[model samples]
Target: MNKASTARVTLDPENWDEFRSLAHQMIDDTVDYLQNVSSRPAWRPMPAEVRNSFSEPVPHSGVGAAAAYADFRERILPYPNGSIHPRFWGWVQGTGTPLAMMAEMLASAMNPHMAGFNQAPALVEKQVVRWVAELMGYPADASGLLVSGGTMANILGLAVARHARCGFDIRQDGLQGAGKRPKLLVYGSSETHTWVFKGLEFMGLGRAAFRSVPVNVDYTINLALLGEMLQRDKEAGHLPICIIGTAGTVNTGATDDLESLAAIAREHNTWFHVDGAFGAWLRISEKLKSLVAGMEQADSIGLDLHKWVYLPFECACVLVRDAELHRAAFASTVSYLAMADRGVMAGGIPFANLGIDLTRNFKALKVWMQFKAHGIGHIARVIEQNVDDVQYLVDYIRKSKEMELLAPAPLNIACFRYIRSGMPDDALDRLNNEILLRIQEQGIATPSGTTVDGKFAIRVANTNHRSRREDFDALLEAVIRFGREVEMK
Candidate 1:
């Protein structure tokens, strides 16, 4: 047998003791960072030298775990986009919890493919879906699956809409191959997040396939106009495949009249989808549940657990009313993946049939642990506090003679800008833009930008549970200081 070969190979560490020590140290470092993160700057730009360090070519030989860990600690971990920081208020980001972090470690160790078949992880995922449906006031048997994020969730919802509404088998015939078909159309408000548009493109429907209906000053879609548009589309021989309502718009966090939209959808025999990415969690809040009143009526909903649910990055769910349609859109058959009546392959719901991705990680663990570790009441209270934090900003802005609100704050977003007497609109826009950049560069706060009623406004979104009222005070003070300094220059 050729002497059975003298050499041996394995990817495990050479010294288990050393590896264990390093892992413990890294864990401690991460905990320390999370514990004291609020004391640090909201963000800091990477220095040129540190940035250049990443430009090096990949190494042919693997570095020891210790060295790789050191590189991550010294370089990558410190220079993230800063969403984990309490004052990092850019783009409705979530701040993770230590409990979720521990759950993540266990998941990584097991490393199971969660894309269905009978296993504990898959079972956990199915249970999580049911829990989410119940939390959101949907039917107990509502079919759903966890996805990467809001974007993929939206894509899944639209793909189902296409299969269910297009009046043909879209899986095999394809959109183009369906001859003389009604030109597939989607409708959403102008203030809806861009992910809806991206979803249309992903479904092989061009941007022209969607119609952007106008929204009122609060950024909610005008229902009267939406009804008119639906009627007009039908009269014009265009197929209105779906009407997407935003539970909380990106610019101002305004919720559309969901019940009215649902009524219109039924009247027109069209699919109604809700982009409730962050706002879907509002269903958990007894005080705020009315804000998303008609969300449960949606044929499909795209909601992100990574946002208001406070899970780590990238955890979204797509819930569909019609289980068969959801499965029909993405399910595939392969001899190797054929269903078995018993054993590990016997679970009825193959998650691979529910949505995209044949291989998925254990995402439901973090979500389930997060919910169990902190009850719904606790999460609702955190979301309520975030809304209060933004209300604090609104009061501060109103008190300041130089600042004004550009849009109403219905949820947790505040859109406002600084003003100076006799300043032209163009100059004011430039000044506010500069002030935003200065705030980010100075690491004071990380509120992003958006246009409100054609005016450039600072869009501060308080989605972090770690945020306090004092953080809003600091952000307002920094804005005034930067506005004046740039004006003087």
Candidate 2:
């Protein structure tokens, strides 16, 4: 046989020792980055040259591992979105733990295809799902699966709810089969995340399917109005299929009366779904758990471990109270993917039967490792501390004459605005917007902006376990300083 004919190509490095050395260096660099994250700015804009570097043509031949790692360290590592920073409170993002980072690396190295079959990864995912269900106070028999994030989790939950409660065979007849019958409707407050509407659209239910109930002064769904809408819609030949209760609204962290919503859902015989996202972790906190009182009563709950549980991105779970119904919504039978009673093809949970996506990564590893390492009690304390820090900021905002509280800080988020006593609403909006930009640009602290009750608000959503009262104090100081500076300019 010709030697040339026998040659094989492999992506593995020819020199394992050199590769190991590079890997060690990469790990050290990551540790250093996390260790000293507090010394760096919460966020920094990427320079034009660095941004332009990404536009380079894709390499047909690989840059050696060390060289590629150098590029990542120089260009990508330094310019994160700042969620990991101690002072970064923007957008309900979590500051991930170093342990989770290690778990991520381990998971990637194994690269398990988590769609199911007899495998330890499959069992790990099942255990993680069980833990999440227990954490959220759901039944031990609840069925769930981890997804990319809150959006996918929520979509899955709603998908199950729609299938189980739509009063027709959604799987077989599709939405069109409802033809000329009462239009199915999902009820939620105006404060519900835009993802719900997107989910409806994706499910072939138009945006009209979502009935937006008005929010009360506290930014929660008004129960009376919700009931009225349900009755009115019913009388008008509309079928209410689901009632979405927000465990925590994105803007203000306002929790709807979930128990009441559950009761209402029961009374109406509609599926009750809760978008817990970051707020479901509040169940772990003794001091704040009461805020999410009725959350467990939800027929389905969508939540994120990445947000409050401090895992890395792309980790969220959707739990359905009825295990069979959950599987029935998404299960598919294919000859090529048939299960077996033994060997590599059998006995483990088939995650593919629970939700969309056949090709899934080992997202459960990081979650399992994080929970095992830190313990839920420790995580709960961190969550409580975050809420306490936000309350401290709220108190500071209340005391400051130049600042106005735009919304109630019920859990871990506070929405407030910098105010000049007589400044018009429009002008104040512009000024606060400028202030927000300046704060981000100046690398002070990153608090996102949102509108509350028609007023622009600097929204501080504290999911960061790294944040402290001092960080929030610093944030307020920068806000006032920028507010005055912007007004003058």
Candidate 3:
């Protein structure tokens, strides 16, 4: 080949020094953004032009790294969902930390495929899983997997429960071949997250397989009604495969009586599973740990480190008490992935054998680094502060004549609505809805809305470690100002 034709092609930067400079500048810009996040709006609507810019045709050629970075800064950086904002309390989202952000970059640079090989990344994931299991009081020897979020975590836990308790070879014959088998069912409180029903549907059980047991006045599952339903289902020839208990309901943070629920599951010989997505982290808190007393007794647990542990997005875990049973549910023997006694392919059980994803990312790096950087004690204190902030808001609502506390604030979520005298329930709902829209549109603070007892409520779920008591004050002041403005309209 001629000299020109012999030139090699590579993705490396043409100028190493220039690329290094650009990388350093990017890191500096990120630090500046994080430090000054509070000065920006919690959220803002994108302008029409900014929105239209995304419709530009893809570049068939190439945009240099510098040009791409500039585009990101101009168009993407300014518009986020506002979960990172200090005043954002919307939908149980976590406000990430600087340390975790840096850890994410490091993990991406390494780019290790997490599907089990004899690699340090696999060991890191295993250690992270062990740390989470120990923190939640689950069995130390339990098998666990780091999943995307609460929904997947819950689904995996329930899948294991089904495999263990179905009394048939579910993996071999599938649900169709279970001839004359009783219809399998799952149970959870009405206050449970929609993940349970969605998980049932994904597992081919249909939504009808989930029995929505009513809750008590406090929003915890009513044990009496649950027992009665279990008896009725049994009489009707339905088999209860799993009993899901909610540790912290999304609406109001009301924890069910987990100990009693565990007892009931034992009595019925059903698998006990706890959906502790955000609340399970309370086990780290000395003051709040008592609320989730019986969670340790669960056959399996689904929890989110992203929400309560304040890690970045897409980090959650599902822990199963019986490691063997967990492996049996998801393990597959692929000839190509066959293990060797000693080589790059042999060490610990591949995470692929425990869950659905065979090609996984190094999601455990951020979790591991965050836990190491900030010890459990410090994290627990942050959680306690969040709960205290919510309690303060609840007390403020109780004292204010224009606001109503619609649900109990047991942990970090407070559900209340703005109200005026002589307004009917329907009118009040409309008024509060307007206030919520105004608060969001005005970029004062992002507090999500939900219906509590047929009344529209402004739901504040405080998972933001950056949140201060003053942020709640700002949120309340904006709510009142917007409430009056909407009422006048």
| Total clashing pairs for each candidate | 0, 0, 0
Q: Each prediction's Cα lDDT score?
A: 0.88, 0.90, 0.92
87-174 per-residue lDDT for model 2 (tens digits): 8988888888999999999999999889897889899999999999998899999999999999999999999988998776765775
lDDT of 3 by residue, 1-489 (tens): 556856788999999999999999999999999999999999999999999999988799888999999999999999999999999998888998999998889999998888889989999999999999999887778999999999999999999999998987666776577776788999999999999888999898899999999999999999999999999999998899999999999888999999999999999999999999999999999998999999999999999989999999989999999999999989888778888888888863579988999889899999999999999999999999999999999999999998989988889999998888888999888998888888888888999999999999999999999998899999999888877777544
RMSD of each: 1.6, 1.5, 1.6
For each candidate in turn, the TM-score is: 0.97, 0.97, 0.97
Per-residue lDDT of model 1, residues 1-489, tens digit only: 477566788988889999899999989998999999988888999998899998778788988898998899899887889888888888788888888988889999999887787789998999999999888878988899999998899889988998889876565776677676678889989887888778788888889988899988778999988888888888888899999999888778999999999999999999999999999889998888999999999999999988898888879999998888888888878888888889878874478888878888899999999998898899999998888888888888888899999899888999899999989877888899999999998888899998888889889987898887788888888888887888544
Model 2 misplacement above 4 A:
1-6, 174-178
- Cα error, residue 315 of model 2, in Å, equals 0.3
Q: Ten consecutive residues with minimal summed lDDT in candidate 3?
A: 169-178
lDDT of 2: 0.90
Question: How many collisions between residues are there in candidate 1?
Answer: 0
